[model samples]
Target: MERTAPRPPPAVDPLRYRWVILGVATFTQAATAFFVQGIGAMGVHLQRDLDISTAQLGLLLSAAQFAPLLGFLVAGELLDRYNERWIVGTGATVVAAGLLLGSTAPGYASLLLVLLLVGAGYSTIQPGGTKSVASWFDPSRRGFAMGIRQAGLPLGAALSSAALPFLAGATSWRATLLAGGLVALLGAAVFMVFYRRPPHVTVPEDGPHLSLGAQLAARFGMVREPSMRKVLLSGLSLISVQCGVGILTVLYLYEKASLEAGAATLVLVASLGAGVAGRIVLAAWSDRVASRYTCVMTCMIAVIAGMAVLMTPLGREPVPASLTFVWLGFFGLGWYGPWLAYLTESAPPGKVGFALGMVMAVNQIAIVLVPPTLGLLKDLTGSYTPAWAVLTALTLATLAATAPAVAAVVSRQGLRRRPPYS
Candidate 1:
């Protein structure tokens, strides 16, 4: 027989595109989250420049979140129906424009209006990003991929938290806002240029759009799923803890630890930096253990421990306080990686967008409620002690909530050997 020439590999490997999706998705997430995450670092600046109370400052954070409350569901339906490239890219452009306009706002309410626009744009990014990356990877590797993508939030936060303090110090908060807007625009540009759906994924055909009644029915149907219900309940408590950590850390340090504003922001930077690493590490760990729930539970435990320290006399001492905050950052922000991965895994086939949007919308309820509530607590008591105690309590509550939720999910999965058929 004559020898045959060896066949060459395909011109483009589908596996390779998954990584491109991850890279662009991660960067877009970072850009979208940058200014919002820096709210804690910018706390002192906003307070002095706007002459706002802690409650008012918390409201600024909440303002950016308010529109997203409903926006996620709308974006979710859009993601399922449209190309993510356009949806995510256009949304980011909106973010840049809103932030640019926000920097020029003459008063607090105007700034809040600008941020509400930013939130409207941002509502698409999370579900869109999660849907983008989840489509690219399979179950085995999904946890790790989701971790890297989700880590973008804290990475952006850490970088901005570190730089924004100095940036605001150098010129003005308005200038800082302009720079952030520019960064978001860059992210939009980069994502538009680099991102494409995986080759195997089909683009939906243009057709009659979902009727309002149909869309509402579909959304309600997803919300009624048991796994989703559990995720919603679990995220409510945990997200409250996460949002509390982000909104309160800087103020807690400046007031409670008696640190200078600069020192406190630096501590906030440290917390977010640790969070970046924790997202990656715990996510990778989930890939290894084959259990996202384990990862979430572990984070809840660490958060409880970190919060306990914060309530102690030891947490009031500067060194211990710094370390405890870093610990909180690790678990506080880390929990989302596995949490999202679990959500992605549990979603009904072909409805990843709806699942992500719906779960996060539920999570937004806590995000909207927690920050200002904590700020109000601090304002009323004139101390962070009550606030920290409240956070500790929330974390403990999440611990109680997570265990049965995870068990229910696992039991439903039939992960354990099924009982002998009758």
Candidate 2:
């Protein structure tokens, strides 16, 4: 009989595979973020067991954020040079290692050091995941895809918020660190095993690579653009609100609203749950709207309203306080989806990773500083009201500064045909 040709393997579908990438990216994001996101949930335990003040508690959280200040810039540069699968997977592994080490921490200072290492690892995930999603999805679906991917943060946060406190309450705070490490290890393994770059994209081997100084100059130049400046401002302001809410929600409810610890934690969970939903809904809405920036602005307005409500007499009541926090969570956390999509769209050609890294690095200044500042305000004033007032005023000031620029951009876009991404 005549020999038959061996059958060729079936080809993978790019469209179907993109969803796989999305799932992996989202899962890895959630897993890597599990411990950090749960810090707020552990506030009561950390304060009780460590015998630390609120400022110290805030400092503990800030420790995890501090390394990301410089790490994001480095990670961004790496993303532009390397494959995300390895960068993100390795980052998650580092997070696992840091958390595992943190479990053995003898005191507040040691825990802070461990979390600083964890923050270094976490710096890779945000820009790496954003760049990966943006590469797969075009403008029309980018916002929605970005939204789903970004939702992983709050999804992980919500799960951690619900689980960590219970774990800490049942065992000890150290056990919660161990649990977070294991989860991060699992996430790292999944991404390393499954993630692959889109098959169609190619890296050019013949192009001249820039020197370190030149590359740094080019990345810094992005800051000079009006649009980028706006993004930086918005990120700084809104992230302060986000961190404030996460750091203070349970404490505020427990101390000011007269709720029990368990009840206060449940409210934090509800707020994070709202954030997950808001990210998806608002990003999808951005897809239909004239501008993604509009969605971000809407979030700003909503956050201001929520904070204003929290400052009122009604915030003292359990029902009203819970409802208002949920509202704050929705807009404050949800804003990241549309805002990231906007940032990705705003990047100059061939520099998405660098732009993300640079802008996010600038934002980290707020993330690191705000938590401690808010905590100190609460400590000095002996009230949560001053902290809330500060966040409200910061956000309001940013809105006022950026409104005219955003409005002009919107008006200009309205007069012309809408771009696919914008």
Candidate 3:
């Protein structure tokens, strides 16, 4: 009998594949989040162009968030059962196409409808891209890997915040959306072409796919786990702070700090750039220290400190205010790096997608409720103080709730000994 020829190996080395996945995950994440985050930067233009109130503009951001409340769960389940490359790539395509179609939107209502579609597509990117990166890196380096991937959001947002206002000024809001859509499509193509599952992540053919009831039950069951409860609660309080910071930074600077529109937007871009750096640095620190919760606690402390500064009269001083907002941007967004790493580490085996989905889905509730509420508060009170104070209290609450977990990690000398999912 003739022997068959030996199978050729893949072009990239297995050892280097994880980094390649990280790069793709990062780009896709940045691309998917670009338009929504850019919306915050374009607030004044949207108000003038669309002739809508602050509340209505807030609603636009809220609209993008609304769909993720449920979409996250569905995407999570699909990720557990499907290939991430296609799920993520397809989702990005949807976002691009939706925005392309949205460019033709006739009114604020039509734009809202278009944003709804963008959110649906975004629902896939968080869990799918995260799960894909998590699969490639073991716990030892997962935090660092995840941080790099998550940084994509802020990095993309920073770039968009810096560019979209100019684009809108030169062209039209519709044209800006068209430009963002094109970037998102490019991201989708990159992810589809380059991403590959790790060799160790083979799916078993014999096991039955999770039934809907079983999947729902599994998700509910995650809520009951003690560690998961802490993670969920931490996310609940922390996400409000994150959303408030993201949505209100430019507005707050323009209105309260007496900055011109261009200067305020420049400040917003700088803050998001800080956030990009913060995610990577904080997550890398978590990996080195092997204490995800400690890193989270550190971030909470930083946020509280930053918020306290914001609450004072001194925070309104132009130079101080810009510095302070960037400080908050660091911790507010930085917390997510370690937070997500801990969440992934805590997940039960084969359930990273579900855990990430459920936790982030619940977090999305805060994202939905908080920004608009803060916007309304700003509208009603004619001040950002109430919003900043509320965020400060929320951060305090999250720190208090997560104390026990952080203490446990500290007691262990800041090292996790086992796979949290196991």
Candidate 4:
């Protein structure tokens, strides 16, 4: 009898449909982030109209960020248990309602409350989108898809940057805020209408499920692994990048660059636009590079950020002003797509959502912690140079840390192999 070759197991059809979910996911990010980030565009207006001090304005901006920190933890756990459409759609509605109410907010206290809602809004997008995207794209295409999705954030910021400043001029700040809020509601409806979670999976062999205490312990256990530890460090890098881009970039342009407020806003907005491209380019190309794309991102970020920090006469002239912001924008925003992809991929399949949440949680903690620390540094030193110096050190430290991470990943596989990308 002829020996029969073993039949190739029927290939499981991957979740190609999840890409549609990604499309909707993009809008949700754009919608929610627009309201929160629009503050930078309207800062001058808020200062003038509300008669708030710079520090007070910073607090309001920071407050929006603060509420979202807790969401990383809560949303992560909930995502693991619930239907994403309901969770995300509901969060979006709440976000919309909060901003609408804030549009007519009578006092600083009300504005703060509205901002709290904005943070809640931000919390939904990532936990929902990250897990959703992971289901559709394989590890190969992940960098691209995640990058594209992340690009929405910059797209949203750019839209707000371009539109809010002009809109603020055209009508009251309340109108601008209301307009953005309404757009977010539409985002909720779109997500509810189109986004679907991947079907529930049951492996032929069920692994032991993690209890709450067990899960936390497992999380710490995962963290202790050298590869996972790199993911966490990358996540911290993410936090610094977020602080630099989302909050500090525009401020750096306006005050330090001494550009007129409108021009400063425009330059920073241009960078946000570039981020949309950077995400697409860097992410898609990540799959083809010699090294795993994360390494490239790690290297690129260190070089660009270090140069930006040391570009000492940064805003002293127009050439440096334009170049620095563009360079800063590239480094600051470009890393999100890959680092997030890296974080998602590095995680075990069963625990991916929770892993992502942990990263986001750390990211939020950094968000809450970093801006204030940077602010205090700026306040005491009376210059951002010292602040930039500190960030520069951290950036370099991240670069040095990558070697061990790559080595650990290699040791696990044994012998030289192709990078994770094809």
275-364, model 1: which lDDT tens digit per residue? 888888887777755357778888878887888888888877888999998888888888788788888877776677877888898889
TM-score of each: 0.85, 0.88, 0.89, 0.85
User: Least lDDT summed over 10 consecutive residues: which range in candidate 2?
Assistant: 413-422
lDDT of 4 by residue, 1-422 (tens): 89999998444434556667778888887886787767876888878878899888888878877766778767766776677787788888888988898889987788988888888876877777777776667767877888899898878776686788788888878887799789989999998987765555422212367466876786557787666777677667655755765556666777766767678767777767766777777776665543354544454565445446434774556657666767666656777777777777677656666677777877788877887888788879887777677666676676678666576655675554334643
Model 2: per-residue Cα lDDT over 303-358, one tens digit each = 98998888899989999999999998889999998899899988876777889999
Better of 1 and 2 by TM-score: 2
Clashes by residue pair, model 2: none
Evaluated at residue 238, the lDDT of candidate 1 is 73
Residue pairs with backbone atoms closer than 3 Å in model 1 (clashes):
none
Report the poorest 10 consecutive residues by lDDT, candidate 1: 413-422
Which runs of model 1 end up more than 4 angstroms from their true locations? 1-11, 43-57, 103-107, 165-172, 203-215, 253-262, 382-385, 408-422
Q: Which residue pairs clash within candidate 4? A: none
- The alpha-carbon lDDT assigned to residue 391 of candidate 1 equals 73
Better of 2 and 4 by lDDT: 2
Q: What's model 3's TM-score?
A: 0.89
How many clashes (backbone N, Cα, C below 3 Å) per candidate? 0, 0, 0, 0
